[model samples]
Structure formats: structure tokens, C-alpha cells
Target: MRPSFLSEPVRVRVPATSANLGPGFDTLGLALALYDDVSARVAPAGCHVDVTGQGAGELPTDDGHLVVRAMRATFDLLGGQPTGLAVECVNRIPQARGLGSSSAAIVAGVTLARALVVDGDQRFDDAAVLRLAAELEGHPDNVAPCLLGGFTIAWTAGPQGSDGAGGAGAGGGAGACRLEVAPGVQPTVLVPDERGLTSEARAALPAVVPHADAARNAGRAALLVHALTAAPELLFTATEDRLHQDYRAPGMPATAAVLAGLRAAGVAAVVSGAGPTILALTSIPDEHLPGMGWAAQRLAVDVAGARVDRGRLGHAERDPVAAGRKS
Candidate 1:
């Protein structure tokens, strides 16, 4: 049966996220205060997207857009497609700066599509949202935090939740655990002007790594959970990674140098996802210069992941320049 569409527009606020925080590659993620505001309404005919902030004129304005594609996928899951879609996006998150912009778009699309359907929640629940979003993004690390908020440990679970050890590799359902960050934990992102290709970064990583390195990463990843929640002081040691960073450093020399410098100065710094951007989990020393094409922003931890409301883009949300932080 075809699903009933809501006449009113539905909007979603999805936070920017940082994935693979050090050792927890493809498993751990953090939601930051920066966000993208997207609103969609059922239309009578064609699909149209009005993008403002980041992508603006560069992104596709039709169904080819990531947000629209996600929404179409969602509508299909909800049993039918609306006649058309009119999407408005006031994007604040950088497009390809390792800030989970793609995941944010995917989450926003799924959330809005679900809200636009009359009985959407009943048909596709929150867990289904996570699962679908993860499938769309091909990984749960970024989508989990963007959807559920805070610090999330996400993995792909096999039949009966038995695949606890799998992180996107198990290929079943998406599962995540959200935890509130410790009060003392501060997140500072050093964003660069150049964009990075996640595919390129992944290609740079070796197919195999030493066993000792994997063991070390496992221990630190475990400690990272505790440090992020209960002991901020231990974050420096806990955020260490023996995985993807070093191998991909040659491609992103600037990020590698800055990360090394920050760590030497006692800051818990890591390459944000597949980088050119750097995420510092601890306070940086005053001497550190965030200049040289790197814009540093100290962001808060967003506890409320993706928020949905029944409405179109208002004055502030349509501004394109202003980041629509929920009041």
C-alpha cells in the first residue's frame, strides 16, 4: 500500500561528527555542535533542492543530491514515494573535511522522510533509521553519532546480536551505544581549506597490519570509552592509534605534521576520519598556531542527535550563513 504523505514540511537538524577518533576506527564517533539544517516538503511534481551554505551551487539540485537520494531510499522503505520533493538545506558542516558531512546529509534525509510520512514512525522506527542510515553511508561510525548524538560506539551485529566484535564488517544490523561525554572533555577541530577524498585515504592504508599494533589499538580503544565518559585526564593516552593514521600520513602531510606537533605539546590530537582535518580531544597549548589555512573551532558535544520538527525553513534556517543551532 502507498504511504500517506504529510502536507506540511518536515525539517531535521543533524550534527557534524568526527569518526575514528584515534584507535576506534570505523567504530567510535563524536557529535559536534556544528550542524546542517534541512527541510523537505511533498511537492506536486519535480524534485528540487535549494542548497545554501557549503555546497551551494556546486551540489545537485535534483534527485541526484545525496539528501534527495537518501530520502528516496527512505520513502521506498516506507512503502511509497511522494509525488515530488522540495528540499532546502542551510548547511554549516564542511563538505569533505572529515566532519561527517555525508553522514549528516544522510541522517537529515532519512529523518525528514520518516517525518513526512503519516505513519512513518510505526513503519520505520528509530532503530530502523540507524540501520538504514548506516547502510546508506556504508559505515555506522559516523551515522550512529549523527543520529543518536554524543559519543557512540557503533558496530554491525550479526544474527541475534552475536557480532559484537564486528565494526561494519559483520554485515547484519547496525547497533550503537551512546554515552555522555565527561564535562572536562573539550573538542577542538582544526579544519583545513583543502578537501580530502575518503576513498583515496582508505586506498593508502595497507591491507594487513602487525598483530601487536592491532592489540595496542584494541586496548586504547577500550580505555578511550572510559576516558571520554569518566576520566578526561586519560584521554591523551587513550586516544592513541596504531591503525590507519601513519600509513595515510604521506598523502596528508600537513595534517600529519600538525597532529604530531599537538601530541608533542600534550594534546590528544588525531586525524579526523580520513583527514586533512585534525580533531583535538584535549586542550591545546596557547603556543599552537591554528593559522596557515587551518581554522580551529572549539565545539560543544551535541547530546541531542537528530531533531525533527514539523515545519519549513524559517528566517534563521534559511540564512545559509548562520548555523541553525537549536534554541
Candidate 2:
């Protein structure tokens, strides 16, 4: 018998996210101009994936696909089932280049899976959807902004209550509070070809940092929010970090140089996520920026976070007006 054909595919578009800007560590993040798109298609009761862009030569094309793994894990968390799957990818964002490629894929999987199980109907709860994305992506900083738009504050537990814990989707207890987003702002993502720092980067630091450093970061994190909203000029002083960036320098030499490049050009930049991609908070205008040549690629802020369509997966429609749903 000939193979059975399935209905049209369920699409998902998860935006590229930047995390740990300066002092925020796992607590702060912003959505960026770049994106990696994932698509979930119903096939004949099995699993298959096709990866193009960035890591196509190195990434998997079958059940082992990271995008597939993320989608499956999401459904598992929600007690859903797999029918069959196919994935088509577009690689506007660079992989392993510190641009939230992994978070993008994880969000895509779960978001698309939910769309399929429910027949691509209904507006999936944004808060609940982000919780799922955070679980898979390892934090809400990157996921939340990608899903909700604008700069966001995410918290992670201090791990056994060490007093540094924070996460946006926390439980009702005092430590578990909701994160917020503001409207009408633009972002700029500056990515360099320098390789990314792995989870191992944390191993280079002492188990504990000085309280002075912690306090300093707290002030900057607050200042960053102010810069994002009303006082962008403060960013030159606001985006400094005593915690993550200096510690990971060994892993990101080019990142350091590129950051200096941005600052010298009067562009306020922080290390994107862990490192490698420097997230620059800026107001968008046709006026050109100077000394941006060092970056591998530069893009404007995209307020539209993770979303879906019939022909694509988490495929974002660019205009906030066209989104039809508020961020």
C-alpha cells in the first residue's frame, strides 16, 4: 500500500533570545533580531527531522533531533502523545554562537506540540507556555522575552535556598513572583564569530562570590531596567557586571574585544546570554551606528516572541500590529 498522507503541518516560531545581560545571570534576558525557526509536521506515525542552516552539517536529522527532543519532552510534561513529525528549519540565527539557538528550538518543540494536540486552535496560555519553555530551555530569561516581548526579569532558586535564587514562574511563595514586560521598545543584537562558553564556564569560578559583587550587580540590574525604559544614557554605567562576564573571559576573548568595540562606538552592549553574542540595548532609527564591523551580524529588536502558523513552526510575523495578540 502507498504511504498515507497527513494533514497540513503545525508551525511554530520561537524568537532568538539573549540571557544574563551583565549582572542578571539567569535572571535577565531580552529578545533579539535574529531567529531560528522550527516546524512540526505530521507524517506516518514516526519521527523525522530536517535541519538546515547553522549546524545542519553537524546536527541530527532523525528522532535524535534537538528540536524533536524538546517537542517530545514538552508533550511528555503535559501528558500528550506523539503521532508523527517532520521539521523544516531556516537558520537566520547562528548556532553555538551564543544567540539563544537552543532556547529557540526548545520553545519551538513544545509550542508546536501543543498546537498539534489541540488542532492548532486557541491561544495557548502565554504564562503556562513559558513555564514549559523555561523547564526545557533551563531558564525563563531567554524564553520569556522571546514569548512575551521586551526586556524581562527571570529568577532562579539559589539552589537549596542560598539567597540568590530567582525565577519568573516561581510558586506562590515570596520567592516565586511573576516577571513583567514593557511595550514600545526596540533591541539590537550584536553577534561575533567567537565560539560560545559552555556550561563548564561556571566551573572556572569559586563556588561563592563576594557580597559586594552581588550588591553591585543588583544595582546594575535595576539600572538596566531603567535604561531599557527611560534612561538609555545610563546604560554605559548600567550594563557593567562583576559576576559573569569577567569570569568567563578565558572562554570568550573575541567577545570582550567586540564589547569594547561597541562601547567605543557609543553603543551600550552586554554579553548575550553566556557569551559570544553581545546584546546591545538601543533605540531604533535609520541613523547608522559606527564601528559595527567587528560583529558577524547585527539586527534590530524583534518584539514578536515565540508564535505559530499553519505552514511554519513558531514562525514569527514581524509587525506587532499584525501579531493580533499582545506581547
Candidate 3:
């Protein structure tokens, strides 16, 4: 009677992210040139991910992987499950390299799953995507920016009572925004020849930071975000942070050395997500990047977030920016 509730498979492309961006620990993030492509072909109840490209050798090949987990969770949120899903992944972004590889997968899975599960109207809501991605990534800083793109500020607040894991909003409620990336800017990413620092390694930062150090970090964080949105000239000054970078030094040897060298060379690079990649936000052009030595490659900023293509399913197109009313 309901036309059989059939929807075509979907494709999603998500960009890798560099979180922290100097002093904005667990807050600031920028989308990068590298990417992960996820294509879903609907079959008949289970979902699976096929690993290829960059992380294939190291990453898992089954449903136990983070991406598959996120996709299945998306089905649960959308009401009922489809018959099955075969996910083809062409991952160019390296895992555990401090790039937001996990966040990228989670984003692609959620966006793709949403397109597959729902009807023409009640698709994955703004809050639904954000909340689920946030919960999966363990924090909103990297996940939010990777999902929304550009420059975003987000913070999570503790619930009023013992009620756990409430998605009230991070930083500025809904905690996402669209800021135009300055035209000439190119993010020089330095991914060291190292493995990665897990989210657990990141969470191990010393809880009690000196008040003075905290203030210094706060200043740099505000300056970095403001520079990104307002004045490009302020980026260099804003890139200095006294927070997580130094604290994370012991665990990430390459990260620490890269950050130190970049700063000494006046590039002011900071730890990218969790470890071996250092990101230098600059409009200084190509010649300057190579001099820093920690670089793998350099490219322009991709402000646009994940993109999903729908073949005929309701003739829908996934709008990366149209998440709706900022609650």
C-alpha cells in the first residue's frame, strides 16, 4: 500500500579534520584536503565496510570498525533497518595520524545511513546527525567541524542532575556555524612518520592546569577563532597555545618535535586531532611550507563538509550546510 518503502543507496564523502588549531582544544577545527569516500549499496539487515586505500592495512575490515558501527546506529535512530548494506570505502586519510580519520568515517556513515533509512520528509534531522556523531566521536570539536566544516565553536555542559550524556549542545548550543574561509589560505599539514595517539591518550591530559597557563591558552584560542573569522593577519599570533600541545608532548614524540620546529621557523604549527600531524594555518603560500620540513603535503582549505549524493531516493540531495535552526 505504501509503495513498498524502497530507497536507493547513497554515497558520502567526508573531509579529514584538524582539531585544536592551537589553543582551541576540544573546540576549534578546520577541514583538510584529504578525504574518505563511502558508498553504500543497499542489500537485504546487516551493514559492512570494505577497507581500501590509506588505512586499509591497519584498520579493521568488518562491522566491528567504527564506521560500520556509526552506520548501524544511524539505522536505529531512523526507526527501522533496511535489508542490508555493503559499504565500499576508499580511504585516503591516514588513521591515528592525528587527523580526524575516525570522525570522518563516523560522519560519512551517518550522512549516508540517513539518506538510506528515511522517507522524503522525515530525514535525519540536524540535531539527530550532530548528536549521534558527537556521541560516537567522544567529543564535538573534531566531529562537529568535520560534519559542518569551516570554523565552528562547540562546548558540552554537564547535566543538571545525575542524568548522563545529555546533548544540550556544545560551546554555543547546537555548537556549529558557517564561516567563510579566507580565499588565499592554505593549510600546510605535517603528518610525521608515526602511528597515532588514541582518544584515550588525548583524554589523559593533566586535569589540573595552572590558572596562568589556562588563561594563556584561552587568549590564544579566542585569538585563533577570531583571526579565522575576522583578520587573517592575526593567525600567526593566535596560533600559540600553552595548553594541550605541551601536555601531549610526552606521548607524541613526532608531534612535539614537529610543533616545536614549526614554531621555531615562525610557522606556528599545532597538533592536529589526537597526534602525529601538525597543522599550520597560513596564507603565506607554497614556498614557505617546505622550509618547515614536517610537511607531507599542502593544500587549500575545504570549508564545505561531507557531501552525499542520492541517485533517485526521493530525488534528494544532501545539503551539507542546511542543518536548520541553530538551537
TM-scores, in order shown? 0.96, 0.79, 0.84
Regions of candidate 3 where Cα sits further than 4 Å from its true position: 1-7, 120-123, 158-174, 283-295, 311-327
Tens-digit lDDT string for candidate 1 (1-327)? 799999989889999999999999999999999989999999999999999889998999999999999999999999989999899999999989999999999999999999999999999988889999998998899999999999999988876546555544344678798999999998999999989999999999998999999999999999999999999999999999999999999999988888998998989999888888999988888788467788888899999999999888888767855645532
Query: lDDT tens string, model 3, 56-150?
Result: 66676667777778877887766666677777777767778878888998988788777775462266676568768988887888777778777
Off by over 4 Å in 1: 161-171, 324-327
lDDT of 2 by residue, 120-212 (tens): 233345556676677776667777777765567766543444664445334422122323333434456656655665476666666788999
Q: How far in Å is the alpha carbon of 326 misplaced in model 3?
A: 32
**Per lDDT, what order, best first?**
1, 3, 2
Residue pairs with backbone overlap in model 1: none
Candidate 2 regions exceeding 4 Å error are 1-6, 119-124, 157-187, 264-266, 282-296, 312-327
Per-model CA lDDT versus the true structure: 0.91, 0.65, 0.70
* Higher-scoring candidate on TM-score, 2 or 3: 3
In model 2, the Cα lDDT at residue 271 comes to 78
Model 2 RMSD in Å is 6.1
**Backbone clashes under 3 angstroms, per model:** 0, 15, 8
Worst 10 residues of 2 by lDDT: 172-181
